[model samples]
Target: MIRVIVCDDQTLVRTGFVTILDAQPDIEVVGEAGDGLAVVELARRVRPDVVVMDIRMPGLDGIEATRRLAGPGVAEPVRTLVVTTFNLDEYVYEALRAGASGFLLKDATPQQLIAGVRTVAAGDALLAPAVTRRLIGRYGSRVRAADPPGAAGGGGANRSGLAPRELEVLRLIAAGQSNAEIAAALVLSGETVKTYVSRILAKLGLRDRVQAVVYAYRNGLADEMGEY
Candidate 1:
């Protein structure tokens, strides 16, 4: 079973999520918190496989909570999935940067929410299609501008130590290509593509493909203006 913790300030919203997630046989709602401050202790105690976090709470807030739970300095970071009612670009970007594996709109369907939790619990990133496009579009230019010269052209030593093929996989990931699509494009098997993706994430020290996408954009490996 995939252990999970749900955190949200609103009682109705928290209960609704718990209700849907608890019904999944493969998932269990082990703990719940109504404030960000309480969540930190709950997470440490429960050590859940995934955390369904709300962006806004009375204290601490989800972003900071995510940072504490999954940030770079964390020794045993937990995977986090941020759920918010607002689709603000800064919130999405900051959540990811804070080490959240993914984000979903609170209005997402029950199936989507379930799928998202499972995805993150299975160690993959989950971003809504529209959220992905909008995030890339709004933040692409900033990422491109932040890159140093010769970084995108592969002229510099691959910072993440990825090989040529692995770099290609990372780019396709940023382009929002699925494993099957990447496999077809590269004339490789699905398992092979999955392996490549795993290696890429491992080498880059990223939590999942969503962080890989962020890494690609920030490092200029992906075209800022390109449609994903």
Candidate 2:
């Protein structure tokens, strides 16, 4: 079973999410928190496979909670799925930067929410390429200039330890291309594109494709003007 912890300031929202999630035979709501501060402790205690977090809780916001649970220095990161009523690009970008594996609007259908939790629990990013592209295009420019892509290598693709072909694949991924699309664009097999994606993520120390997209945009590897 996929263990999950639900965190939201509103009791109704928390209950609603739990109800929807618990009905799934493959999922279980092991814990729930109405405050961000408590959610961290709950997560640590439960060690859930996925966390459904809300953004505006009192005490500590979901972004910080996410950072604590899944950020860079974490020895055992838990996958987080950010769910909020607001669809602001800044929130989406920040949540991903804080190590959330996925972001979803609160109005998302029950099926979508269930799918998102399962996807994150299964170690995949719950992002649609088209939606991710839009979010990045709107907020990517706000990223600091000092943090260019390949900052480790003075803004070179080598910083992520990706080969030329892998770099190309990553660029396409940043452009919101699916594996099949990337394969067709590069005239390679689907399996080959998948392999490149895995290699890129492994070398970059990234959690999933969402993080890859964020990294590409933050580092200037992907541009708003780039054709998809």
TM-score of each model, paired residue for residue: 0.86, 0.89
lDDT of 1 by residue, 1-228 (tens): 999999999999999999999999999999999998899999999899999999878879899999999987789999999997555677777778788998999889999999999999988888765567567546754744343222233423445488978888888887777898889888899999999998877766566887777777777777633333
> Which residue pairs collide in model 1, if any?
none
Off by over 4 Å in 1: 140-156, 224-228
Reference-based lDDT, each prediction: 0.81, 0.83
lDDT of candidate 2 over 1-228, digit per residue (tens): 999999999999999999999999999999999988899999999899999999888899999999999977789999999997545668778888888987888889999999999989988887766577787767877877455432243344444477778778888888877788899988999998888889888787676887788777777777633453
Among these predicted structures, which one has the highest lDDT?
2
- Candidate 2 residues lying further than 4 Å off, grouped into runs, are 148-154, 157-161, 224-228
